[model samples]
Target: MTTMDLHSMTGAYALHALPDDERAAFERHLAGCASCAQEVAEFAATAARLALASSAPARPEMRERVLHRIGTVRQVPPSAAPLERVRRGAARGRGAARWALAACVAAATAFGGTAVWQYERAQDARHDAARAERQAEQVAGVLAAPDARTRSVRVAGGAGTLVVSAGRDRAVFMASGMPEPPSGKVYQLWFDDGGTMRSAGLMDPGRSTQTVLMRGAVDGASGVGITVEPAGGSRRPTTAPIALLGMPA
Candidate 1:
Protein backbone atom coordinates (compact mmCIF):
# COMPACT_ATOMS: atom_id res chain seq x y z
CA MET A 1 0.00 0.00 0.00
CA THR A 2 1.07 3.58 -0.61
CA THR A 3 2.08 5.77 2.33
CA MET A 4 -1.15 7.72 2.10
CA ASP A 5 -3.22 4.60 2.09
CA LEU A 6 -1.43 3.35 5.18
CA HIS A 7 -1.82 6.68 6.98
CA SER A 8 -5.57 6.71 6.33
CA MET A 9 -6.00 3.29 7.85
CA THR A 10 -3.93 3.92 10.97
CA GLY A 11 -6.86 5.30 12.94
CA ALA A 12 -9.13 2.35 12.25
CA TYR A 13 -6.33 -0.03 13.10
CA ALA A 14 -5.62 1.87 16.32
CA LEU A 15 -9.24 1.44 17.36
CA HIS A 16 -9.25 -2.20 16.25
CA ALA A 17 -12.17 -1.29 14.04
CA LEU A 18 -10.77 -1.81 10.57
CA PRO A 19 -12.50 -4.22 8.23
CA ASP A 20 -11.04 -7.75 8.26
CA ASP A 21 -9.28 -7.61 4.89
CA GLU A 22 -7.70 -4.23 5.46
CA ARG A 23 -6.76 -5.09 9.03
CA ALA A 24 -5.15 -8.36 8.04
CA ALA A 25 -3.19 -6.69 5.27
CA PHE A 26 -2.01 -3.92 7.58
CA GLU A 27 -0.95 -6.40 10.25
CA ARG A 28 0.94 -8.47 7.67
CA HIS A 29 2.77 -5.34 6.59
CA LEU A 30 3.26 -4.05 10.15
CA ALA A 31 4.99 -7.24 11.26
CA GLY A 32 7.96 -6.43 9.06
CA CYS A 33 7.49 -2.65 8.99
CA ALA A 34 9.00 -0.57 11.80
CA SER A 35 7.87 2.83 10.45
CA CYS A 36 4.25 1.75 10.05
CA ALA A 37 4.21 0.29 13.54
CA GLN A 38 5.42 3.51 15.07
CA GLU A 39 2.94 5.47 12.98
CA VAL A 40 0.06 3.31 14.19
CA ALA A 41 1.01 3.68 17.87
CA GLU A 42 1.19 7.45 17.65
CA PHE A 43 -2.06 7.67 15.72
CA ALA A 44 -3.77 5.45 18.32
CA ALA A 45 -2.67 7.74 21.12
CA THR A 46 -3.97 10.80 19.27
CA ALA A 47 -7.26 9.03 18.57
CA ALA A 48 -7.53 8.34 22.30
CA ARG A 49 -7.11 12.04 23.04
CA LEU A 50 -9.84 12.97 20.59
CA ALA A 51 -12.16 10.43 22.14
CA LEU A 52 -11.48 11.92 25.58
CA ALA A 53 -12.35 15.40 24.36
CA SER A 54 -15.90 14.40 23.66
CA SER A 55 -17.78 14.98 26.91
CA ALA A 56 -20.17 12.20 27.82
CA PRO A 57 -23.74 12.87 28.65
CA ALA A 58 -24.15 11.84 32.27
CA ARG A 59 -26.17 8.78 33.16
CA PRO A 60 -28.16 9.21 36.36
CA GLU A 61 -27.52 6.72 39.18
CA MET A 62 -25.43 4.68 36.81
CA ARG A 63 -22.54 4.40 39.24
CA GLU A 64 -24.65 2.75 41.94
CA ARG A 65 -26.23 0.31 39.55
CA VAL A 66 -22.84 -0.79 38.24
CA LEU A 67 -21.26 -1.22 41.66
CA HIS A 68 -24.14 -3.36 42.81
CA ARG A 69 -23.73 -5.71 39.90
CA ILE A 70 -20.00 -5.97 40.37
CA GLY A 71 -20.35 -7.00 44.01
CA THR A 72 -22.31 -10.08 42.95
CA VAL A 73 -19.79 -11.27 40.31
CA ARG A 74 -17.49 -14.26 40.93
CA GLN A 75 -13.72 -13.95 41.24
CA VAL A 76 -10.93 -16.43 40.64
CA PRO A 77 -8.04 -16.76 43.05
CA PRO A 78 -4.48 -16.79 41.87
CA SER A 79 -2.96 -20.26 41.34
CA ALA A 80 -0.77 -21.44 44.18
CA ALA A 81 2.19 -23.81 44.05
CA PRO A 82 1.44 -27.33 45.20
CA LEU A 83 3.50 -27.07 48.38
CA GLU A 84 2.13 -23.62 49.12
CA ARG A 85 -1.41 -24.77 48.61
CA VAL A 86 -0.90 -27.75 50.92
CA ARG A 87 0.59 -25.54 53.64
CA ARG A 88 -2.22 -23.00 53.34
CA GLY A 89 -4.84 -25.72 53.44
CA ALA A 90 -3.41 -27.09 56.68
CA ALA A 91 -2.93 -23.66 58.31
CA ARG A 92 -6.16 -21.92 57.36
CA GLY A 93 -8.61 -24.84 57.52
CA ARG A 94 -11.98 -23.04 57.64
CA GLY A 95 -10.28 -19.61 57.59
CA ALA A 96 -9.12 -20.24 54.00
CA ALA A 97 -12.72 -20.06 52.84
CA ARG A 98 -13.17 -16.69 54.53
CA TRP A 99 -9.96 -15.37 52.90
CA ALA A 100 -11.12 -16.53 49.54
CA LEU A 101 -14.47 -14.80 50.01
CA ALA A 102 -12.76 -11.60 51.09
CA ALA A 103 -10.47 -11.70 48.12
CA CYS A 104 -13.44 -12.13 45.83
CA VAL A 105 -15.23 -9.19 47.41
CA ALA A 106 -12.16 -6.98 47.10
CA ALA A 107 -11.59 -7.94 43.52
CA ALA A 108 -15.17 -7.25 42.64
CA THR A 109 -15.06 -3.80 44.24
CA ALA A 110 -11.88 -2.88 42.42
CA PHE A 111 -13.10 -4.10 39.07
CA GLY A 112 -16.48 -2.52 39.62
CA GLY A 113 -15.22 1.01 39.13
CA THR A 114 -13.32 -0.03 36.03
CA ALA A 115 -16.36 -1.72 34.59
CA VAL A 116 -18.49 1.37 35.19
CA TRP A 117 -15.91 3.54 33.50
CA GLN A 118 -15.87 1.27 30.49
CA TYR A 119 -19.66 1.28 30.29
CA GLU A 120 -19.82 5.05 30.43
CA ARG A 121 -17.23 5.29 27.73
CA ALA A 122 -19.22 2.90 25.61
CA GLN A 123 -22.30 5.02 26.01
CA ASP A 124 -20.37 8.12 25.10
CA ALA A 125 -19.04 6.41 21.99
CA ARG A 126 -22.48 5.41 20.92
CA HIS A 127 -23.65 8.98 21.42
CA ASP A 128 -20.96 10.33 19.14
CA ALA A 129 -20.58 7.44 16.75
CA ALA A 130 -21.07 9.31 13.47
CA ARG A 131 -18.99 12.34 14.39
CA ALA A 132 -16.25 10.18 15.85
CA GLU A 133 -16.13 8.00 12.74
CA ARG A 134 -15.74 11.01 10.46
CA GLN A 135 -13.03 12.51 12.60
CA ALA A 136 -11.30 9.16 12.96
CA GLU A 137 -11.24 8.77 9.20
CA GLN A 138 -9.80 12.24 8.79
CA VAL A 139 -7.09 11.65 11.39
CA ALA A 140 -6.39 8.16 10.09
CA GLY A 141 -5.90 9.51 6.58
CA VAL A 142 -3.18 11.88 7.75
CA LEU A 143 -1.38 9.17 9.69
CA ALA A 144 -1.63 6.93 6.63
CA ALA A 145 -0.46 9.55 4.12
CA PRO A 146 1.52 8.10 1.25
CA ASP A 147 4.59 10.32 1.16
CA ALA A 148 4.32 11.31 4.79
CA ARG A 149 7.12 10.64 7.22
CA THR A 150 8.11 11.54 10.78
CA ARG A 151 11.39 12.88 12.18
CA SER A 152 12.78 13.46 15.66
CA VAL A 153 12.89 17.06 16.95
CA ARG A 154 15.13 17.83 19.88
CA VAL A 155 13.41 19.70 22.72
CA ALA A 156 14.82 21.09 25.98
CA GLY A 157 13.39 18.51 28.38
CA GLY A 158 12.84 15.27 26.48
CA ALA A 159 12.31 13.35 23.25
CA GLY A 160 10.30 15.37 20.77
CA THR A 161 9.30 14.47 17.24
CA LEU A 162 7.44 15.92 14.29
CA VAL A 163 5.09 13.98 12.03
CA VAL A 164 4.47 15.84 8.81
CA SER A 165 2.31 14.46 6.08
CA ALA A 166 -0.59 14.97 3.65
CA GLY A 167 -4.33 15.03 4.22
CA ARG A 168 -7.39 16.28 2.38
CA ASP A 169 -5.02 15.74 -0.53
CA ARG A 170 -2.58 18.39 0.72
CA ALA A 171 0.19 19.10 3.21
CA VAL A 172 -0.94 18.25 6.75
CA PHE A 173 0.58 19.38 10.07
CA MET A 174 3.73 21.34 9.34
CA ALA A 175 5.33 20.57 12.71
CA SER A 176 4.16 18.99 16.00
CA GLY A 177 5.78 18.43 19.39
CA MET A 178 4.95 17.84 23.07
CA PRO A 179 6.21 20.30 25.68
CA GLU A 180 5.61 20.39 29.41
CA PRO A 181 2.69 22.48 30.58
CA PRO A 182 1.72 24.02 33.94
CA SER A 183 -0.06 22.21 36.74
CA GLY A 184 -3.65 21.29 35.86
CA LYS A 185 -3.00 22.20 32.22
CA VAL A 186 -2.12 20.62 28.89
CA TYR A 187 -0.85 21.57 25.46
CA GLN A 188 -3.35 21.81 22.62
CA LEU A 189 -2.97 21.83 18.83
CA TRP A 190 -4.71 24.13 16.40
CA PHE A 191 -5.24 24.52 12.65
CA ASP A 192 -5.29 28.12 11.46
CA ASP A 193 -7.90 28.73 8.81
CA GLY A 194 -7.65 32.42 7.95
CA GLY A 195 -7.86 34.26 11.31
CA THR A 196 -9.62 31.42 13.12
CA MET A 197 -7.90 28.62 14.96
CA ARG A 198 -9.77 25.35 15.15
CA SER A 199 -8.79 22.74 17.73
CA ALA A 200 -6.77 19.93 16.18
CA GLY A 201 -6.20 17.90 19.35
CA LEU A 202 -4.84 17.86 22.92
CA MET A 203 -1.55 16.81 24.51
CA ASP A 204 -0.58 14.80 27.57
CA PRO A 205 1.80 16.32 30.11
CA GLY A 206 3.72 13.08 30.50
CA ARG A 207 4.25 12.64 26.76
CA SER A 208 7.49 13.82 25.19
CA THR A 209 6.81 13.01 21.57
CA GLN A 210 3.59 14.14 19.91
CA THR A 211 2.19 12.77 16.65
CA VAL A 212 -0.19 15.19 14.94
CA LEU A 213 -2.41 13.81 12.22
CA MET A 214 -4.30 16.53 10.41
CA ARG A 215 -8.05 16.24 9.99
CA GLY A 216 -9.57 17.38 6.73
CA ALA A 217 -7.11 18.62 4.09
CA VAL A 218 -4.35 20.90 5.27
CA ASP A 219 -4.89 22.67 1.97
CA GLY A 220 -5.28 26.21 3.29
CA ALA A 221 -3.91 26.17 6.81
CA SER A 222 -1.65 29.19 7.29
CA GLY A 223 0.01 27.56 10.28
CA VAL A 224 -0.14 24.94 13.04
CA GLY A 225 0.22 25.75 16.73
CA ILE A 226 0.60 24.39 20.27
CA THR A 227 -0.80 26.15 23.31
CA VAL A 228 -1.24 25.51 27.05
CA GLU A 229 -4.83 25.26 28.12
CA PRO A 230 -7.08 23.63 30.70
CA ALA A 231 -7.55 19.89 30.48
CA GLY A 232 -9.76 18.74 27.63
CA GLY A 233 -8.31 21.62 25.57
CA SER A 234 -10.26 24.61 24.33
CA ARG A 235 -12.61 25.55 21.55
CA ARG A 236 -10.14 28.32 20.71
CA PRO A 237 -6.51 28.79 21.61
CA THR A 238 -6.17 30.42 25.04
CA THR A 239 -2.47 31.15 24.80
CA ALA A 240 0.30 31.81 22.29
CA PRO A 241 1.60 28.68 20.68
CA ILE A 242 4.67 27.31 22.40
CA ALA A 243 5.60 25.92 19.01
CA LEU A 244 4.48 27.16 15.63
CA LEU A 245 4.80 25.04 12.49
CA GLY A 246 3.49 26.51 9.28
CA MET A 247 2.89 25.46 5.68
CA PRO A 248 1.80 27.58 2.75
CA ALA A 249 -0.78 26.19 0.40
Candidate 2:
Protein backbone atom coordinates (compact mmCIF):
# COMPACT_ATOMS: atom_id res chain seq x y z
CA MET A 1 0.00 0.00 0.00
CA THR A 2 1.08 3.57 -0.63
CA THR A 3 2.14 5.73 2.31
CA MET A 4 -0.97 7.87 1.94
CA ASP A 5 -3.25 4.82 2.02
CA LEU A 6 -1.41 3.51 5.06
CA HIS A 7 -1.75 6.87 6.80
CA SER A 8 -5.46 7.10 5.95
CA MET A 9 -6.09 3.65 7.42
CA THR A 10 -4.66 4.64 10.81
CA GLY A 11 -8.04 5.59 12.25
CA ALA A 12 -9.82 2.58 10.73
CA TYR A 13 -6.97 0.40 11.86
CA ALA A 14 -7.35 1.70 15.38
CA LEU A 15 -11.06 0.85 15.12
CA HIS A 16 -10.19 -2.57 13.72
CA ALA A 17 -12.37 -2.23 10.63
CA LEU A 18 -9.83 -3.26 8.05
CA PRO A 19 -10.41 -6.53 6.16
CA ASP A 20 -8.00 -9.38 6.65
CA ASP A 21 -6.06 -8.55 3.51
CA GLU A 22 -5.99 -4.86 4.34
CA ARG A 23 -5.05 -5.58 7.95
CA ALA A 24 -2.18 -7.81 6.88
CA ALA A 25 -0.91 -5.14 4.54
CA PHE A 26 -1.13 -2.50 7.20
CA GLU A 27 0.60 -4.67 9.78
CA ARG A 28 3.38 -5.41 7.32
CA HIS A 29 3.77 -1.70 6.74
CA LEU A 30 3.62 -1.00 10.46
CA ALA A 31 6.44 -3.49 11.04
CA GLY A 32 8.82 -1.31 9.09
CA CYS A 33 7.00 2.00 9.47
CA ALA A 34 7.86 3.57 12.84
CA SER A 35 6.13 6.84 11.90
CA CYS A 36 2.86 5.12 11.03
CA ALA A 37 2.92 3.03 14.20
CA GLN A 38 3.51 6.15 16.27
CA GLU A 39 0.58 7.81 14.56
CA VAL A 40 -1.59 4.79 15.31
CA ALA A 41 -0.62 4.98 18.98
CA GLU A 42 -1.62 8.64 19.12
CA PHE A 43 -4.96 7.91 17.47
CA ALA A 44 -5.66 5.02 19.83
CA ALA A 45 -4.77 7.19 22.83
CA THR A 46 -7.04 9.92 21.51
CA ALA A 47 -9.90 7.42 21.16
CA ALA A 48 -9.35 6.28 24.73
CA ARG A 49 -9.51 9.88 25.88
CA LEU A 50 -12.70 10.36 23.88
CA ALA A 51 -14.20 7.51 25.87
CA LEU A 52 -13.30 9.35 29.09
CA ALA A 53 -15.23 12.45 27.99
CA SER A 54 -18.42 10.35 28.06
CA SER A 55 -17.75 9.51 31.70
CA ALA A 56 -20.77 10.32 33.82
CA PRO A 57 -20.68 12.50 36.93
CA ALA A 58 -20.32 9.48 39.23
CA ARG A 59 -23.88 8.17 39.21
CA PRO A 60 -24.56 4.51 39.87
CA GLU A 61 -27.10 3.95 37.08
CA MET A 62 -25.13 5.96 34.57
CA ARG A 63 -21.98 4.11 35.52
CA GLU A 64 -23.76 0.80 35.05
CA ARG A 65 -25.04 1.72 31.62
CA VAL A 66 -21.66 3.04 30.55
CA LEU A 67 -19.93 -0.08 31.76
CA HIS A 68 -22.50 -2.27 30.02
CA ARG A 69 -21.95 -0.56 26.67
CA ILE A 70 -18.22 -0.54 27.17
CA GLY A 71 -18.30 -4.23 27.89
CA THR A 72 -19.68 -4.90 24.39
CA VAL A 73 -16.67 -3.41 22.66
CA ARG A 74 -13.17 -4.86 22.85
CA GLN A 75 -10.72 -2.92 24.96
CA VAL A 76 -7.36 -2.04 23.50
CA PRO A 77 -4.60 -1.53 26.00
CA PRO A 78 -2.51 1.61 25.73
CA SER A 79 1.09 1.31 24.62
CA ALA A 80 3.10 0.30 27.71
CA ALA A 81 6.66 1.02 26.54
CA PRO A 82 6.72 4.34 28.37
CA LEU A 83 5.58 2.71 31.62
CA GLU A 84 8.05 -0.10 31.11
CA ARG A 85 10.86 2.41 30.62
CA VAL A 86 9.87 4.20 33.81
CA ARG A 87 9.83 0.90 35.70
CA ARG A 88 13.36 0.10 34.49
CA GLY A 89 14.54 3.47 35.72
CA ALA A 90 12.81 2.85 39.07
CA ALA A 91 14.63 -0.43 39.40
CA ARG A 92 17.94 1.44 39.16
CA GLY A 93 16.85 3.89 41.89
CA ARG A 94 17.78 3.55 45.60
CA GLY A 95 14.18 4.21 46.72
CA ALA A 96 10.99 2.68 45.26
CA ALA A 97 8.78 5.45 46.67
CA ARG A 98 10.60 8.22 44.80
CA TRP A 99 10.46 6.28 41.52
CA ALA A 100 6.88 5.35 42.22
CA LEU A 101 6.01 9.02 42.74
CA ALA A 102 7.72 9.92 39.48
CA ALA A 103 5.79 7.16 37.77
CA CYS A 104 2.53 8.43 39.26
CA VAL A 105 3.36 11.93 38.00
CA ALA A 106 3.97 10.55 34.52
CA ALA A 107 0.69 8.64 34.60
CA ALA A 108 -1.17 11.73 35.79
CA THR A 109 0.31 13.82 33.02
CA ALA A 110 -0.57 11.22 30.44
CA PHE A 111 -4.12 10.93 31.77
CA GLY A 112 -4.56 14.72 31.88
CA GLY A 113 -3.46 15.09 28.29
CA THR A 114 -5.66 12.20 27.23
CA ALA A 115 -8.62 13.54 29.18
CA VAL A 116 -8.39 16.93 27.51
CA TRP A 117 -8.16 15.37 24.07
CA GLN A 118 -11.07 13.06 24.87
CA TYR A 119 -13.21 15.96 26.14
CA GLU A 120 -12.97 17.65 22.77
CA ARG A 121 -13.75 14.40 20.98
CA ALA A 122 -16.66 13.79 23.33
CA GLN A 123 -18.05 17.24 22.58
CA ASP A 124 -17.73 16.57 18.90
CA ALA A 125 -19.37 13.15 19.28
CA ARG A 126 -22.22 14.73 21.22
CA HIS A 127 -22.73 17.32 18.54
CA ASP A 128 -22.75 14.66 15.87
CA ALA A 129 -25.17 12.51 17.86
CA ALA A 130 -27.52 15.46 18.42
CA ARG A 131 -27.44 16.39 14.78
CA ALA A 132 -28.15 12.81 13.74
CA GLU A 133 -31.01 12.55 16.23
CA ARG A 134 -32.59 15.78 15.01
CA GLN A 135 -32.41 14.63 11.43
CA ALA A 136 -33.95 11.33 12.46
CA GLU A 137 -36.78 13.01 14.42
CA GLN A 138 -37.47 15.29 11.50
CA VAL A 139 -37.76 12.30 9.23
CA ALA A 140 -39.91 10.50 11.79
CA GLY A 141 -42.15 13.55 12.13
CA VAL A 142 -42.59 13.75 8.40
CA LEU A 143 -43.39 10.07 8.17
CA ALA A 144 -45.68 10.21 11.21
CA ALA A 145 -47.37 13.50 10.42
CA PRO A 146 -49.62 13.66 7.35
CA ASP A 147 -50.03 17.38 6.56
CA ALA A 148 -52.05 18.12 9.77
CA ARG A 149 -55.33 16.84 8.29
CA THR A 150 -54.72 13.12 8.86
CA ARG A 151 -52.99 10.35 10.83
CA SER A 152 -50.82 7.52 9.46
CA VAL A 153 -50.19 3.81 9.97
CA ARG A 154 -46.92 2.37 8.68
CA VAL A 155 -47.27 -0.84 6.62
CA ALA A 156 -44.08 -2.70 5.88
CA GLY A 157 -43.77 -4.60 2.59
CA GLY A 158 -42.50 -7.70 4.39
CA ALA A 159 -40.63 -8.86 7.43
CA GLY A 160 -37.53 -6.78 8.08
CA THR A 161 -38.87 -4.17 5.66
CA LEU A 162 -39.28 -1.54 8.37
CA VAL A 163 -36.56 0.18 10.33
CA VAL A 164 -37.42 2.15 13.43
CA SER A 165 -34.73 4.49 14.71
CA ALA A 166 -35.35 4.66 18.45
CA GLY A 167 -33.22 5.08 21.53
CA ARG A 168 -33.38 2.52 24.32
CA ASP A 169 -35.71 4.72 26.36
CA ARG A 170 -37.87 5.73 23.37
CA ALA A 171 -40.22 3.90 21.02
CA VAL A 172 -40.34 4.90 17.34
CA PHE A 173 -42.13 3.54 14.31
CA MET A 174 -41.36 3.90 10.60
CA ALA A 175 -43.87 2.51 8.13
CA SER A 176 -45.54 2.98 4.78
CA GLY A 177 -48.94 2.53 3.08
CA MET A 178 -51.51 0.38 4.94
CA PRO A 179 -55.13 -0.24 3.99
CA GLU A 180 -57.83 1.08 6.29
CA PRO A 181 -59.78 -1.44 8.39
CA PRO A 182 -63.44 -2.34 8.03
CA SER A 183 -66.35 -0.33 9.46
CA GLY A 184 -66.98 -0.39 13.26
CA LYS A 185 -63.31 -1.34 13.71
CA VAL A 186 -59.99 0.52 13.47
CA TYR A 187 -56.38 -0.53 13.09
CA GLN A 188 -54.69 -0.51 16.49
CA LEU A 189 -50.94 -0.76 16.71
CA TRP A 190 -49.42 -3.29 19.07
CA PHE A 191 -46.05 -4.73 20.09
CA ASP A 192 -46.28 -8.54 20.09
CA ASP A 193 -43.52 -11.07 20.56
CA GLY A 194 -45.46 -14.20 19.54
CA GLY A 195 -47.12 -14.17 22.97
CA THR A 196 -48.57 -11.07 24.72
CA MET A 197 -49.58 -7.82 23.02
CA ARG A 198 -48.88 -4.22 24.04
CA SER A 199 -50.60 -1.19 22.59
CA ALA A 200 -48.52 1.16 20.46
CA GLY A 201 -50.99 3.70 19.10
CA LEU A 202 -54.30 3.95 17.34
CA MET A 203 -53.64 4.32 13.59
CA ASP A 204 -56.23 6.51 11.94
CA PRO A 205 -57.50 5.61 8.49
CA GLY A 206 -56.01 7.66 5.68
CA ARG A 207 -58.09 9.21 2.89
CA SER A 208 -56.19 7.03 0.42
CA THR A 209 -53.70 4.16 0.33
CA GLN A 210 -49.91 4.57 -0.13
CA THR A 211 -49.31 7.13 2.61
CA VAL A 212 -46.75 7.41 5.40
CA LEU A 213 -47.31 6.53 9.07
CA MET A 214 -45.36 7.50 12.13
CA ARG A 215 -45.93 6.86 15.85
CA GLY A 216 -44.51 8.61 18.85
CA ALA A 217 -42.79 6.92 21.75
CA VAL A 218 -45.34 4.80 23.60
CA ASP A 219 -45.22 2.72 26.73
CA GLY A 220 -45.53 -1.12 26.53
CA ALA A 221 -45.14 -1.52 22.75
CA SER A 222 -41.42 -2.13 22.71
CA GLY A 223 -41.99 -4.19 19.54
CA VAL A 224 -44.30 -3.18 16.65
CA GLY A 225 -47.72 -4.71 15.85
CA ILE A 226 -51.05 -3.94 14.19
CA THR A 227 -54.48 -5.31 14.93
CA VAL A 228 -58.12 -4.41 14.28
CA GLU A 229 -59.90 -3.07 17.35
CA PRO A 230 -62.72 -0.67 18.22
CA ALA A 231 -62.88 2.70 16.46
CA GLY A 232 -61.52 4.62 19.43
CA GLY A 233 -59.04 1.75 20.15
CA SER A 234 -58.44 -1.08 22.56
CA ARG A 235 -56.00 -1.55 25.39
CA ARG A 236 -54.93 -4.74 23.62
CA PRO A 237 -55.91 -6.54 20.44
CA THR A 238 -58.73 -9.02 21.10
CA THR A 239 -58.46 -10.64 17.66
CA ALA A 240 -55.70 -12.01 15.42
CA PRO A 241 -53.20 -9.63 13.83
CA ILE A 242 -53.93 -7.68 10.69
CA ALA A 243 -50.17 -7.07 10.29
CA LEU A 244 -47.02 -7.19 12.40
CA LEU A 245 -43.47 -5.85 12.42
CA GLY A 246 -40.68 -6.48 14.88
CA MET A 247 -37.08 -5.54 15.59
CA PRO A 248 -34.61 -6.82 18.15
CA ALA A 249 -34.93 -4.88 21.36
> After aligning candidate 1 to the native by TM-score, how far in Å is the CA of 37 from where it should be?
23
TM for candidate 2 is 0.31
For lDDT, the strongest prediction is: 1
Tell me the TM-score of each prediction against the true structure.
0.39, 0.31
Taken over the whole model, the C-alpha lDDT of each candidate is 0.60, 0.57
Task: Give per-residue CA lDDT, model 2, range 30-108, as digits (tens).
Answer: 6555456656666666756544434446767887899899989897764699879877887777477788878877776
- For model 2, the superposed segments whose C-alpha errors exceed 4 Å read 1-161, 166-168, 207-222
Q: Which digits, one per residue and each the tens of the lDDT, describe model 1 over residues 90-134?
A: 778768788997887676555454444433433333445545455
Per-candidate RMSD, Å: 18.0, 22.3
Model 1 earns a TM-score of: 0.39
Whole-model lDDT, model 1: 0.60
